[model samples]
Target: MTPTGDELLAMLSALANPLRLRIVAQLAGGRDYVSHLAREIGISRPLLHMHLQRLEAAGLIVGSLELSDDGKAMKYYEVVDFDLHLTASALAEAVRTLPPTDQEKP
Candidate 1:
């Protein structure tokens, strides 16, 4: 499904980070667990989790829980199938649809 204006902005914001971009690149190969991703990406689990949450919220990635061999629960994440053709006009239109920021608040 095509993302709504706010949804597109959220997805764009989620991908704006370098670390999150790397996470996307890694997950592009295959689904992976948080610990493994943190190790591979050279970051802490907490940090990875923060980025993962954002990606999941933006619908850029999907996460599922699984029981490992030793009966341990693991959460794995993978990129979702989302196609976005971000042209200048598309971005401008999307940006125009966003609600005013807190700075605009009285």
Candidate 2:
């Protein structure tokens, strides 16, 4: 289903953070454990988890619980889809809302 404006905004907002973007990019590779992501992204485990929860809520990613060989439970996350699937209008709207770059400043 096509996302509504608010949904789009939430998704965009979730992605606005640099660390979140990195998380999405990493998830695009394949399913990965939260601990692995935290280490790779260089963010504290708690902070990374907070960002991940937001991303999951936005439907940008999904997490599944798994049992490791050691019998420890772990949560692994993966991008819902390989593509971002933003509509043209959404892209245009987002671009319009962006602040002017240095080149655009007088």
Candidate 3:
């Protein structure tokens, strides 16, 4: 189902963090195990899992349990959709809410 304006805003807010953004970017490449993501993104496993949970709550990503060749259970995460087309109004709203940069600060 398509998300509403409020849902989009909440999702965007969840993604506004730098670490979460990086995690999303990495997931965009392909599905990856949580541990692998933590290693690749240079964050702690617990912290990565926390961010993953937030992303999942936003409905931006999904996770599933998988078994490795060595018989270990792993959680893999992937972007829910490769094509996320935001409405023009939503895009405008997002742009308007961006934080001011150092140069733009009063």
Candidate 4:
């Protein structure tokens, strides 16, 4: 689905951070639980969660809660299969469908 301008902006903003980009790259390899993902990325779980929430809010990634073998609930995250086609024409089309932003209002 073609994202609306606001959605596009959200996705881009979410990925603008280096840590967030790294998080996406790591998840691109495979789905992983929060604890393992935090460890692999060498960041604290709380910080990882902050980035994860941003990705999730942008629809770039999704998280699901599941029970581990020991009956512990774990949150697993994976990247969403989204294709962003950015070009002059695409941007124009997206802008055409965009709702006016605060700055755009007189």
Model 1 has an lDDT value of: 0.92
lDDT of each: 0.92, 0.86, 0.86, 0.94
* lDDT for each residue of candidate 2 in 14-105, tens digit (9 for 90 to 100): 99999999999988888899898999999999999899999999989999999999999999999887345777986776666666789998
In model 1, state the lDDT of residue 105.
68
Candidate 4 structure quality by residue, lDDT tens digits, 16-99: 999999999999999999999999999999999999999999999999999999999999999998888888887787788887
Model 2, residue 91: C-alpha shift (Å): 7.5
Point out the higher-scoring one by TM-score: 1 or 4.
4
Ranking by TM-score: 4, 1, 2, 3
Whichever of 1 and 3 has more lDDT, that candidate is 1
- The TM-scores of all predictions, comma-separated, are 0.84, 0.77, 0.75, 0.92
* Best candidate, lDDT: 4
Which candidate tops TM-score? 4
lDDT of 2 at 13: 91
Pull out the clashing pairs in model 2. Answer: none
lDDT of each residue in 1-106, candidate 1, tens digit only: 4466899979989999999999999999999999999999999999999999999999999999999999999999999988999888887777777787999768
